[model samples]
Target: MLRALIYCLAPPPPTVNLVSNKSNVVRGKTVPNGTVSIKINAKVYMGRSDAKGLFNIKITTLAAGTRLYVTVTDKYGYTSKERVVIVVDRIPPAPPTVDSITSKSKVITGKAEANATVIAYVGSQKIGSAKADKYGKYTIKITPKKSGTSIKVVAVDGSGNQSVGKIVKVRP
Candidate 1:
């Protein structure tokens, strides 16, 4: 006599949002009473889902662009397909530092987070944009404006996070 037992595959994959590097917890949903596991670098973390299929697991801080692998295992011991999550940068760079600008000046120079994009604006109109070098130095060419005119400079990181704007006044 041949006996056959049917068993379902692993629990459905969990759902999670695109997380930031600053995130310290991973939350998601899967099969009720199932187990969820996360792998980051060489570390693995495990947690059980609630009756509502929700799970929250704490993790150490991750650097931007780090990858996390998640899986859910049903009571039958079957594991679901692996899910990949990537960490992003959510922290903005510091405001740019601007050198003194005179009405006769033809360029704006400053330092910001390395490789960040620097944008200069006069009111709502953008004057110019430049990318900071590895040394955090940048220069933007612009036509000389009237003395006392105010220009705003901001630094944007690779993740599109903008820093606070710095105000620069055109000197006589």
Candidate 2:
């Protein structure tokens, strides 16, 4: 009597977390002891999954919007499909610089990161928001406030990172 053996053709793809510009390593999960490969900017990095099926690969820090491709190969020489990840910007943009805010003024002018969204707040209430131009200039329209009213402004980058607030006091 003769017996036939069936072999698995490929391993399952690895699961990776969301990567960001602040990340210096790529971490993911695959088959236990499987070989893991990461490709970023056409450069390939190799690593191995631990007994718990978790793997981490150290590589050069990548900028926001960079793309990483990952794959896994099991001990049976079966390779998985490629996984794609995009790095997000985790670093906040610089605080916006605002012009004078007077009691009679209806517009707020500022400079911030190019294409970032600038938001103005009075206490905890949002007043106005605008997107900065290519030159990092923005103007937000808001209702006039009384003298000594404090207006706080912040810049939010494309990746949703928000900077510390810049406070301006409304003058008479």
TM-score for each of the candidates: 0.91, 0.89
Q: Where does candidate 2 stray beyond 4 Å?
A: 1-8
| Every candidate's lDDT | 0.91, 0.92
- At residue 94, what lDDT does model 2 achieve? 95
- Model 1, 149: alpha-carbon shift in Å? 1.3
Expressed as tens digits, the lDDT of each residue in 1-172 for candidate 2 is 1222222467778999878898988898999999999988879999999999999999888999898889999998878889988998899999999999999999999799999999999999999999999999999999999999999999999888999999999999
Clashes per candidate, residues 3 or more apart or on different chains: 0, 0
lDDT of 1 by residue, 1-172 (tens): 1222222455567887667888999988888888899999999999999999988999998999999999988888878878999999999999999999999999999899999999999999999999999999999999999999999999999999999999998999
Candidate 1 shows a clash count of 0
Looking at candidate 1, what is the lDDT of residue 69?
A: 94
Best by TM-score: 1
